[model samples]
Target: MKHLSPKQKASIALAALRGEKISKLSSDYQVHPNQIGKWKKLAEEELAVLFTDKRKKENHSQERIIDELYQTIGRREVEISWLKKNSSLSYPERLTLANKEHPDISTLRQAELLDISRSSIYYQPTVNPGDIQIMNSIDKIFTQCPFYGHRRIKPELKEEYGINIGKKRIISLMKEMGLNAIYPRPKLNLSSSDKQHKKFPYLLKGLPIIRPNQVWGTDITYIKLKKYFAYLVAILDWYSRYVVAWKLSPTLENIFCIQALEQALKINKTEVHNSDQGAQYTSLNYINILEESEIRISMDGRGRCMDNIFTERLWRTVKYENIYLNEYADIGEAGQGLSEYFKFYNEKRRHQSLDYKTPAQIYFAKY
Candidate 1:
């Protein structure tokens, strides 16, 4: 009559399924043969569940049903609690005394008994008008020709939309919106060379990336909210196009970029890490992490775009698909939305460049 924990029970169940004799299992586990026999009997009666696919299928189905039921129960419980507190019935007697007279009692009772709700739920989000219009225009133009720089985009705005905006303003806006021209094109912004950090040559020029951890590229992109802006830095795998790690910050500081690099390194160490010669990337603190990890540092050639093409493509996809679709009201909303989009990008959305397979699929294909 000894009580067994779930782990002990699982051990017994697994041992019984492996066809080990009861006496042998008892001896090995330092328990009595009767205990082993009892465990075996219990295991045998439920053992089919361990091997049968239907058991897992049913469990998953039941879990989903249970989650939905719990949600419904929670909502009804809130309503019942509200009615009890607000109505004439005392809190303790509300369920019994107010059950018959209350109109919502029936629904609450149904939800409580069945573990489901009958109420409809809807969500309405507020959006900024100016941000919406700007995002819409950015989406349209970026989709048509991703290689068009802000110089070309600024003129297009005036000629096509009749909006007279300066190139500097458009460039600033483009950076804020995380829009960038495709790689191998002209550089939009110049990196600082005044820093004392050592710059490395691009080592991926002729290298064939056949494995996931062979090469990693990092870059920073701007994210625009309704009234403010944030910066996002991501380290991506060159071979699989998978984002290893990412970070968001209010300013284009070196700390946030370094934090992202540290997170990515913790997941998996890469043989070579590449980045543009931006000050943040070239800072001593940022470069030291790679040096400590023994990761080969690679920097894009001055004003060269093709050196970091993959990261550019990632920015383009994110901006067009998620960032430009809606005007985020704050940094929190932008972070949440971008996180969801990245999840979809990594796990669900298929990329043509990756043979129509998701980044997760390609990244784990070899394993």
Candidate 2:
């Protein structure tokens, strides 16, 4: 009784499945016909499972990564919540806790994770009480009308709130507050003209988005908190206007943007992904994720906000509906509030553009 190798057994089994006569396989392999038949039956029983096992492995890996991320998020949330709860400690005091020599996280990330701006870490200028009032007014105005720039806001400030503030002051304050007007700017591509970051052209032009996963538009917007602001990045399905995934970060770092994209991929992949020419969207790591997913990359042209219009609309909706109304006390509050708001936005809020159907309804209609 000569022992057969696994490779030889597989070869014999393949031949059997290919319709070769069992007697011929047994003769070619110099094995008993019954042994050949057993191998063929085993292969037949396990062949389908081979492919299934591969998929299960991939899914398990993905699930493990997602679980790790959730754990990190939960731990980070606890730390941030503790910091926020201690109102006696100023942001400057919190900034001092960032260790420069930290191995895992950088100082910049530490500042962001602590919900303090990097610039504020170095220079904690005493802000005037009046300036805060003016900034709050500006936030309100910007939330309602994102297209309003300093020039437009100056007049609105005088007219709406009757706050007679100088244009230079408004400009400086808006810059410090990171409240840039959302409008088209010509030659914006030249800003990203550096060799490192490459920009893609708008691919959604004249293309109809007819299904849930046909196109996904993503963008980052500022969410106003009581003391500071956080950035919100979201990926939305263009056809159903469903928010696939969203992340709130205290900083404008590309990591949050990449996280949102990765989370959305875990839900479902899109044929084409559209985004603005912001550094977050054009960053190498962010672009690599989309490219690895085989998604067609589409970028807004020269500060054309309308190219990723659906995401822009999503920001406006989120702000007006949930953000401005509450004016979240801190990042901890903002995160919890946004979690609920997004659930409502997806599951309850009806959109007229969707023929008065909720985003969840339209998104899951095919399923």
Q: Could you give candidate 2's per-residue lDDT for residues 107-157 as a string of tens digits?
A: 545654654444434543355768777887887887678778888999899
* lDDT for each residue of candidate 1 in 194-263, tens digit (9 for 90 to 100): 3566878889878899989899998887666676556678899999999988876655546556657767
TM-score (all chains, Cα) for each model = 0.58, 0.63
Off by over 4 Å in 1: 1-146, 168-190
Best by lDDT: 2
Q: Clashes per prediction? A: 0, 0
Candidate with maximal TM-score: 2
lDDT of each: 0.67, 0.72
